[model samples]
Each structure stands twice: as C-alpha cells, then as structure tokens.
Target: MNLQDSAIVQQFQQHCSLTEEEKVLLLELEQNPLKVNAGDIIWQENSKVDQFCTISQGWAYSFRNLGDGSRQILKVYLPGDIIGMRDFAFSNRLAGVAMIEEGIVSHFSHEHLLKIFRHSTALTAGLFAIACRQQAVLTERLIYLARRTAQQRLAHFLYEMYLRLGRIGAADEGRFRLPLSQEQLGDILGLSAVHVSRTFTAFREDGLVLRDRHRVTLPDPEALAQLAEFDGGYLNDAVPALFFDREWQSHMLAGPTARSDEQMPGKSKAASAD
Candidate 1:
C-alpha cells in the first residue's frame, strides 16, 4: 500500500485534490523508509529541523524535557501522523520527538516540501488545515491539564484517543492499543507518576477503562465522554459543515475494518494492572 492509501492522506486528498505532479513529488519524497527503535532519540530540542516525517507504523511522541529530569509529552504521533508540518516554518525546535516503539517513518527534506507547497495551492491549504487542527488539539490538551480533574483528564484523554484511532482505522468501537506507559500518560497530563497510577485505579473502580500492557479498552465510550464532559465535535476541523456532513462521516468510516457493535472494554474484573 502507498502513503495515499492511508486514511489521513486520503482525507487530505478529499478535502483538496492534489495534482499529478504533486502526487509524484510526494512519492519521491517518501522514497526512503526510516526506522527508529523504541527508546531511540529521533531529534533533540533546539535542533534545526530540516525534514518532515510521517509515521508509517507504530507510535512516537514529541515532548519537552524539563530541567527537573521530567518530560512533558506534547503530542502522540500515530500511524498516518505527520511531524514537523507545523514547525517547518520555524528554524529551531522547542521540543524533542522520539519513537515509542519500533516503527517505520517516511521523510522528506523541508525545503522540498516548501517548494511543493509553493507549486500546489490545494496541497498547501490542506496541509495548513491539518497543521492548524493539530495545534488546536494540543491547545485543548493544555486546557485539560490546567483545569480538569485527574479523572476527567484521563477520561477525556482516552476518549480523544479512541476517536482519533477510529478516524485512522486503529480502533474498534471503544477498544484500541494505548502504546504508552502510565509514566508517559502522567507526563502528558501534567500529573505525577504516582497520581497517574492512583487515578487509573480509580477509573477502573468506577467502570471506565482497563489498561493492559500498551493497550487500553473502554467499555462505555459514551459514558466516558459524559464523565469527561467531552464533546467529540472539537476533534473535528473548524469547518462546521465537516462536523455533521455524511461525506465526512463516511470518510471517517472508510477503513479496512468495521467497528464491532458488541463493543466492550478489554477491562475485566480480574484484569491486571500493567
């Protein structure tokens, strides 16, 4: 399968059609496959970012390392996610990005990307819209950390992940691979490691979710959204019509697999904490 076969790339094309030359350019850009192992550093803070990358498989994260030996995860990059799209205009990076598991990524030089944009209006606008959406997601995450309760934050986080995964064909109903540790979750939520552990316990006790090794399954996504006071509408683009149009809905549903109606979280009464 090609990069265009991926759901996100498909979404981009549907929103704004790419020309034949642009498609050829993208294919050339993705000619080489880059691999990074778990725990390997991809890029460091303040480094000059010369390339843009798209995750072809597995997970990675962008984070800022605090002086106190802690890291704040800013965003999780999943398959079909592009990094450096938002930061390419800037000369310096404020955070580091790394792979969370063994993964393959596609890369292109930033200057070449700029050139493509200069030549293709459709590509530029679609990319800009995607980047702006990512910025909004990050900004909302900051608001959650600053103002929401631990339980609420965790619930919102899980719901958001499920929704995103569903978009990219990674989730079936409420269940999906989490691919991050509690410590990492803590970092993302601005909580201490211990607090993350305890909050997770409480969430389970209240019948929210079950966290297994690198997997989280939600039994009741609707209830979870209610608990978190989350509205899935925010996860959509700023375009109001996109939020409710059947075409966009069909796009989200156009995946290789169908979400099971008999959905249950992987959580069981005897489930062990990872």
Candidate 2:
C-alpha cells in the first residue's frame, strides 16, 4: 500500500494541515520495508526502544505476558500504525509486539523522529493528537473492564473496532474483517476463550452480530451501540487549535500566583465551554 494513502497519513491530515513536504517526510519514514510472518515476535518487552516501525501491511498487536503464562493484549494495530511511540520516552519496550498475520513494516530511528519533531511543528502536533487518541482508547478500556458487564464489554469492543476499521474503508454496512481469534479477543477483554465463544453465540441470537468466518456484520449497529453503551464522540477526528489571546496571557501570568487553582489544564478546558 502507498504510504501516502495509509490510515495514519490520512489520520494525520485529519488532525492538522500538512504541507506536501511534510507528506514527503511521512512517506520517507516508511521506506525500506521488511516483510514479517504471522506469529513472529517483532520485539520483546524490555528491548531497546531506539527505533519504531510503521505497519505497511497486515495486522499486529502489543501485549504483556502475565506471570501465569497468560497475556493481556494492550493494543491492536492495523496497517499504517507507527509502533513504539508509547515507549518513546523510555529506553526499553513497554510491551511485546507480534505479527497477528503476515505483514510488512518499516523501521525508523528515534534520532530521525527527533529531527522530524524539531523540523515540523504541524506534524509534531499531529503526532501528539494521535497519541492522545490512543491514550483515550486505553482509558476507555480501563473503564469498561472495571465497570461494564461482559456483554457490554464485548459489544463496545466490536463497535469500536468497526469504527476504527471504517476509517480506512475496511468496514462498511457493519461488516468488517476481524483478524483476531477468540483467545485474542478474550485477552483483550479479560475474558476466557469459552466466554468469548458463548458471548458470540449470544450476540448472534440477539441479532447483534452475524459472523462468517473472520468477518462480522452487525445487523443493527444502532441497537448494538445502545447495548454497548458506546459513546463514539471521543472518536471524532479533529484537532482544532486553541488561539491564545491577551486575557489568556494575563491568566498565564496571574493564574499561577493569584489563582493557582484555576490553572489546571482540565479546568481551563472546561471553562472554555462558556
């Protein structure tokens, strides 16, 4: 697939305006691809984090291997995702990454990324926006795992995947290719393999899903979304700028000393709703 047309590139454009030069930089970053096989461990946890890679083809996932020989799947990757950014501030990998299926990846050095960060503010902000979206997904996962019911969790996950895959036109009319196994789904949702199977049966009987091998087609996406209690608002793709002014400058100068309590970022954001 062309790097210019990849999901990450399109997503970056959604978050910020990109110059043709910046677009070329993105293309250059994904050059010199290496082919990988399904089940290949791309990198082990605790490995040096001096480099990151973009998924040029196929699918992959990051996971933590628990002491009991089980796994907790952290993030699923589709084509165009640049891996290793989560560990950019660290010297070692935070989680192990593996190929879910045969794919290709292009490795780039941290030094090169730093150069891009310095040279392109637009791209840098775009990257930051993308990272925030990833963080939001993890935060939502934490919430659902702690509070949502099994069916709710499963519903939410499927719906989320549908939306994400839809970005690249991989999903339409509620149908999409799910490259994950029942065991992998269990790991992601903290369920047993049997539980995943049973839940799939329940979903089918309830008219929530229609499965044909690895492809799932939601019969009634709206109804399924209601059952999932899914708030897709967070998935909205935009990174509008906050135009600071003299009042904001005064707040920066005085809020720290005069009214420190108002200086919280979340508080400022909420105040902007006015």
Candidate 3:
C-alpha cells in the first residue's frame, strides 16, 4: 500500500479528520521510510531524541535495562502506533526500541511536529490524544504486573493485543501473527520461560486458545476476557469532539475501518468501540 494510504494514516484520520491544508502538511512531514530488520535496535536508550516514527508495518517493543543488566520489556508497538511519543518531553530516550520483525517506519522530526503543533490545532490535539492513549497502555501494563495473577496477566495481555491489532486491521477471527518467542514473552509478562510454557499448556488444556507456532487463535474471546477481567474501555475512549471534524463522532465508535482482510470476528462488521 502507498505509505500515505497505510493503516497509520487511517488511524490518524479517525482520531481527527485533517483539513486539506493539514493533510498537505502531514505529507510534507513524511520522510523516506526506514526499513528495520528483525531484532534491529531502532532507538537506543539514552540516545538523543530528535524524531519519532509511526509503525507502518510489523511489530516492535520498548524496553529498559536495570543496573543488574537484566532487561524489562516495557511496551509493544504494532502497526499504526506512534513510536517515541513518550519521549517528547525529554531530551534523551528513556528506553530502547527494537524491531520484532522486518518492518517499515516513517519518521517525523521534532521540528516538523512542532510546526504542526503551532499551525494546526486539530492535528495537534489528535496527536496529543494518541499520546494519552499510549500512556494509558503503559499504566495498565504496570497494574497487570503488580496485581494480576499469572493466568490473569497472560490472559489480559493476549486480549489486549487482540484489541490493539484489530484496531489496525492486523488481526481477524481472534487469530493473529505473534512473533514473540517464549523467552520474549517471559520478558514482557514477568515470567520465566518455563513458566510461560506452563501457562500456555494450561491455557490450551482449558481450550481458551489455539497455538500453531507463531500464530494464535482465541476461540472463545468472551470467556477469555472474563478470565482476564479485561475491560477495553481505555482503548476506545472518544477523542474530545472539539478538535475533530463533525464526522468524528460517527467514526469514534466505529474506529478505523480495517485496511486489510484481517478483522476481529465475533463482533459487528464495524470495529466496536466497546
């Protein structure tokens, strides 16, 4: 797909419709896209922070390293997510990001972002809203790590990924490509690799999920959500109406239409806000 017509653009449009001039400004901000190989470090910890990028394809993650030299996976980035938004307030990166698979990212320099902020209230507000949502995801992950049980944590994580990937048309029928290895899953979920393996066995025995190597299928989403106590409300909150087009309200509940054949099954054809 054309870079401008990609899922990230559709996601931005859903947040706030751009005027013709604003759209042109966005086009100008799109630098030549970067191709990232699997396991490549896209952003290094403590690096100078001068630009951000959108995940035009594939998956990546942010992680921090402790004094003990152990790594903690912070958050996962899917297609359409704006990477590095969390560092906008800082002069240097707080965490490093690495690609989980070969992917493309579109860069926007800090100067270009400032230009949009000064000239387009609607676009600025939309970007701010997206940043807020990203923060919410972090907060929820912290909560899950601190309070949820192992089973609950894994369940919640899977359900959350389903919803997030579905928003970008990367998931369908409760099935999606999960490129993380058992070791990586353990890193993110605070489990040992053995524990991750055991948890998968338990989930399979319960018939909650079907796994075929890197592909995952949630056969009974409602049951799994119930187990996780997952509430998708945080992911679906409406952007404030003032910064959006008149049509924004209608699209708010519908979300960005799927740009690929993948879609969430067992829901309405339109992406459900709930």
Candidate 4:
C-alpha cells in the first residue's frame, strides 16, 4: 500500500479539499520514518526546535520536568498528531517529547511548514484551525484541574482520549487502548500516583469506566461525560469555508503576502464595540 493520501492529511484538513499540489505539500511532512522504541526521547527540553514530526505508527507525548523533581505531561500524541507544533516559533524546545509505545516518526524540517504556508492558504487555514482547537483543549484542561474532583478529572481525560482515538479509527464505541500507566496518568492529571490509582478504582467501581489492563471500554460514554461534566464541543473545528482562485487552484499565488496591522489588536477595537 502507498503512504500518500494517508489518514494523517485527511485528519488535518477535514473541512477543505486539497488540490494535487497541495496534497504533495502535506505528504512531504509524512516522509522519512524513523523507528523508535518506547521511552525514547524524540527531543529533549531546550534542544534546538527546527523540525516538525508526525507519529505514523504509535503514541508519544510532550512533557516537562518540574523543578520539584516531578513531571507534568502537556499533551498525548496520537498517530496522526503533528508533533513539534507547540514550539514552531521558538528557537529551543520548552518541553521534552518521548514515545509511549514503539512507533515510527516522520521528522521534517520547519522549512517544510514554511513551504506549506507560502504555497497553500487552505492548508494554513486547516493548521490554524487545528491549533485553535488544541488551544481549546488546553483551556479545558485548566478548568478541570482547577475545579473538578479527582474522579471527574479521570473520567474527563479518558473520555477525551476515547473521542480523539475514535477520530482516527483507533477507537470505536468507547473501546480503545490506553497505553499509559497510572504513574503517567498522575503526571498528566496533576495528581500523585496513589491519588490516580484511588480515583481510577473509584470510577471503575461506579461503572463510569471499565478497564482490562491497558484496554478501556466505556460502557456508557454519555454517562461518563455526564459524570465528568465534560463538553465534547471543543474537539470539533469551526473553520469557515475556504475558496481558491480558478486560475491558481493548486496553490496560493507567489507574491508579497498580506501584512498584519501594526496597531493590530487595538485596531480591531477601533472598528466595532458590539
């Protein structure tokens, strides 16, 4: 089977159709897979941030080691996830990324992204939409950590994972593999190992979640969402329809790009108050 036209591109641009040349730009990011084992560090914190990567096989995550000798996991990388995006603008990595399972990573230079941005406005829009959606996820994470109970946090995290996996067909009907351990969960959830274990057990007993080792099955995802007070709306993108010129359908025309207002934010305020 060919690697081009893979699900990774489809996930990134669910709302727009890519021209043939645009598809090539997207596929360029998926080239050159390097096999890595579990616990492998793709890149360390403070390393030079000049690349973008895609997980073509398994799972990975970005995390930070706290000064107090603990870890704080920032995001779980699924198969179709574009890693290194969080640091696209930075000269050095703010956090370290590592593998959660043996997987293949397609690593490409940050310049490849520049090519996409210069070549395809539709792709740029898709990428921005994804970034905004991810920002929403991070915002929800904040709310859960600050206001939710331990059980609520656990349920919300698991259900969120279920929905994410379902998008890539790795999960279905609430059945999915969570390749993470209790200790890892603790890092992601801002809880101690024992607290995560206790909360996991409590939710299990309450029939909010069921697990067989690493495999989790949500017997009633609706009920689980209810218990967590979770909102799945953030996962969906609301990008507006993008249009391309008939003469330049495959890519954006080459020229000086539009400049942002120097006054920017304040200028928008000058335009409208309602």
Q: Pick the candidate with the highest TM-score.
A: 4
- Taking every candidate in turn, the Cα RMSD to the unseen true structure, in Å, is 13.4, 5.4, 9.9, 5.0
Compared with the true structure, all predictions reach lDDT values of 0.75, 0.82, 0.81, 0.81
TM-score of each: 0.82, 0.86, 0.85, 0.87
List runs of model 1 lying over 4 Å from the truth: 1-3, 237-274
Overlapping backbone residue pairs in candidate 1 total 0
Q: Write the per-residue lDDT of candidate 1 for residues 30-116, one digit (tens) a residue.
A: 566788799777788899877878787788999999999988998999876787676677888878889999988877787777786
Global local distance difference test of model 4: 0.81
Residue pairs with clashing backbones, model 2: none
Measured by lDDT, the strongest candidate is: 2
Q: lDDT, candidate 2, residue 46?
A: 85
Q: What digit string (tens of lDDT, one per residue) describes model 2 on residues 1-274?
A: 5556765577677676677787878877777789999999999998888789899788999999999999899999988688878888998898999999999988888877887897776677678878888899889899899999889989999999998888877999999999889999999999999999999999999889989889999989889889988988678644455321123444454545656456543336632523
Off by over 4 Å in 3: 1-4, 245-274
What is candidate 2's local distance difference test score? 0.82
